[model samples]
Target: MHTHTSTVTSDSPLFDADGVLLHRHPDLWFEDGSVVCRAENTLFFVHMSQLARHSVCFRDMFSIGTHSTGTEASIKSESGVDEFPDYPVITLHDSAEDVGNLFTALYDGPNFGNNDPLDFRVVSGVLRLSTKYIIDGLREKAIVHLSQAWPTTLKGWDTREDTARSFEMKTGSSSGHMYPSPIAVINLAREVDAPTLLPSAFYDLCRYTYSQIFEPSEDDPLYVPLTYSNASPAASPGPHSGPMQLSLSDTQRLCLGKESALHAITGLIQSMSHSQSIRNSGVQLQSAFSFSHPLAQNPAHSAIIPHASNHHNPYHIHFSNHRRSSSNLICVSAAACRKDFSELVELATQHYVFDRERGFSDPLYVADELGQLKSAEFSNSDAPECKACARSLELWAARERERIWRMVPVWFRLSMDVGAERTASPPVVDIN
Candidate 1:
């Protein structure tokens, strides 16, 4: 229970509870009932009574002598001389540098080449002691060892025989690959913004399958067949079930008609002079069909005008006489309308004039118009006869207009004129 205090000075003896003198190192002292030690370049004070109670061996060793000579001799003469002391020696010095070097020798050891487990144990012991005593160098070295050890151990797993070996080689053996599942892989990719490792062909197949299942259209008869075969359709009927219940055969027929109409419209538009001319020509044809007879309305049976000049000039043609029957002008069927309109779009795209035409003359405008017509209100109704006829005429007109519009471009018009002139002039072929 004796309490003593001392200031660190040269040749101070650090003592334990039994009044045992531990070390006569350069640092250690007692003053005002407290013991002071220099560690990591700083002065630390502890009550002599508390130090004595907590470190009995330290006190006994200290009481023995100022240096470890007597203690070493006694330990050598006793059993198990090689055993480390149960308690470590605490030193006190006037300067932090002296104590730091002593601690480093004990902790790091004079030579790191000695791989003895005792050396490692000593290093660990010194780290705990340094922490308790606030020895900065020892604490820092301990932290370095702790930080470097785990990663080194993990990297060693690379040589192990396991399925994870390949993965380790590629991505490294961090906790990142410890337990990856399909869901986890997907989540990780999304979280890290990484690309999925799927192939391009897989992506294409997925897209094709998706389109086959979900591409919108009331006219598609295979809607049911394609839908029933796909998981997406079964899970979610989507927004257009009523109109999409068409038979597979019906869908095929509709697709063929649509394609044919598109080709026909495209060809006609390609032949037109100006977008306006196509519109005018369409109006004229509607009028002609409406006034003549039902027999005249057959698009397939009608003879096509071989030359542009032979056809009535669209600019001069008027629908005034057929105004009363304008709505009755049956031109083409509804099923063929979309195809025909697509052809007009192609023509208009080719003949685009940046400034002359307004909104309705544009290809986008024609596409919008066709899009509106194909919506539920038009295509899903029961008026197939009237709807089909009206759609066909509109399709043809739109195509003609687009073709003419495309022709208005300076480059296209010039090319056409040159081709025409060349055709008019007979080729000079020399036979050898």
Candidate 2:
């Protein structure tokens, strides 16, 4: 606020009228300030040092002796009169509300309100201007807020303790208001090129029907933001209403990502469901007759141990089955073994489709399980009815996990031996 400390003329009312005439916004007014920033024809009185500290863009701009838009851009006039100087105004193209939101986070200390669920407007504004102005501190703060909404890592996703993720309006017609959609967040993420937020945002989007995902107002591309003033709740409220939205190109990319994920995962699951030919892999299942099968009836065959101490012994399995022919290998407790195998499959499937409350559109789960290396989960909990059956089942399960491990990248649809391109369908099952 600037005022004439001295009376310009006697009729000017000496020592009576207010000193300054700059219009001040309710939310943006700072009792003490260095310069005024204008946005959408609205003026925000703020401190120069505070803006400089938080934003390199603002810092660099402030460093210039002149404001680029006005006479401040040039050296003082020959008469030494400033270029319409009313506290060195810097005009910005952003909306007044957005600019005000951004400054509140900055000058008031980023987390001033201490609200659990953030005001969506504040979060979006901070992210937008912070990124635009190269405000690393504020950008990081906004990313922290974003991480709460979309966990960046499996661990973070698993531990929902990160924060109660939600959004609301702080004040205005929308005070205490909840925005029913994440589209706002999603659109803002895209506008800001925020990749970390994409996976969860896209996953959240998948839950909505195509029509529900996009509102009719979205066609305008400009009319969808339920501005804080006179904002109306989206008539059909669900989980994803906000200013952020997916662009057509982004929507197509998401479709591709989903297709690739499902295809690779389905292929991996199919490959894992069937038994592999172990003999071709230099592994064999031996007759354990230890459980009183025909082979165990032959005392001589029962003498061979699991060969645990001798890696020299070729991989083999022993089972008690009625028909012991040259090819068909069977487990004495075939049902139990099958049940155990199913549990592993369930884990693999869960990994592929979803994990840590996060999502997967592909067979990254194969690599994830393989990375864990404990793929074969064996539970001797109640003990199998037959020791020979248990032994054979254990050996078979272990061998299968090892085989799967060796073919992880392949199971994940990688065509190359190490990391070839993944196919949407299962690779040819190697008979060998």
Top-scoring candidate (TM-score): 2
CA RMSD (A), model 2: 16.0
- Which 10 successive residues of model 1 have the least lDDT summed? 197-206
Candidate 2 — worst ten consecutive residues by lDDT sum?
423-432
Query: How much is the lDDT of residue 387 in candidate 2?
Result: 40
Flag regions of model 2 displaced more than 4 Å: 1-23, 67-86, 112-118, 160-182, 215-245, 264-272, 275-334, 337-432
TM-score of predicted structure 2? 0.50
Each candidate's TM vs. the true structure?
0.17, 0.50
Q: In lDDT terms, which candidate is top?
A: 2
Predict model 2's lDDT versus the native. Answer: 0.46
Q: State the TM-score for model 1.
A: 0.17
Local accuracy of candidate 2 as per-residue lDDT tens digits, 1-432: 454122122122111012222345777656566666766545666888998888777776777745434442221222343423445667676657667778988867776333223465566677777777777777778878767656554334323222222222223222112232445555666556565665554544443334445553543322244443311121112234454345666667555545544565555555544532122223433323223222333444322323233332222333222224323443434455456546656766676556323533423334334323222343334535434333343344333333332332232232232222212212111010
The parts of candidate 1 lying over 4 Å away from their true place are: 1-102, 105-115, 133-137, 146-153, 156-432
Model 1, 1-432: lDDT tens digits are: 323223334344443333334443232322332333434234333344544343443344345534332342221112223111222223442234334343445433533212122233333334334444444554455434422211112111122213334545776653223221112122221222222211111111121122332463433211332332111221213344431322343234334433333443344444332222112244333422233332224344232212122222221112232232455654334234434445544545554432112211223233333323333344555533344334334443433333333332221112232223111112121110
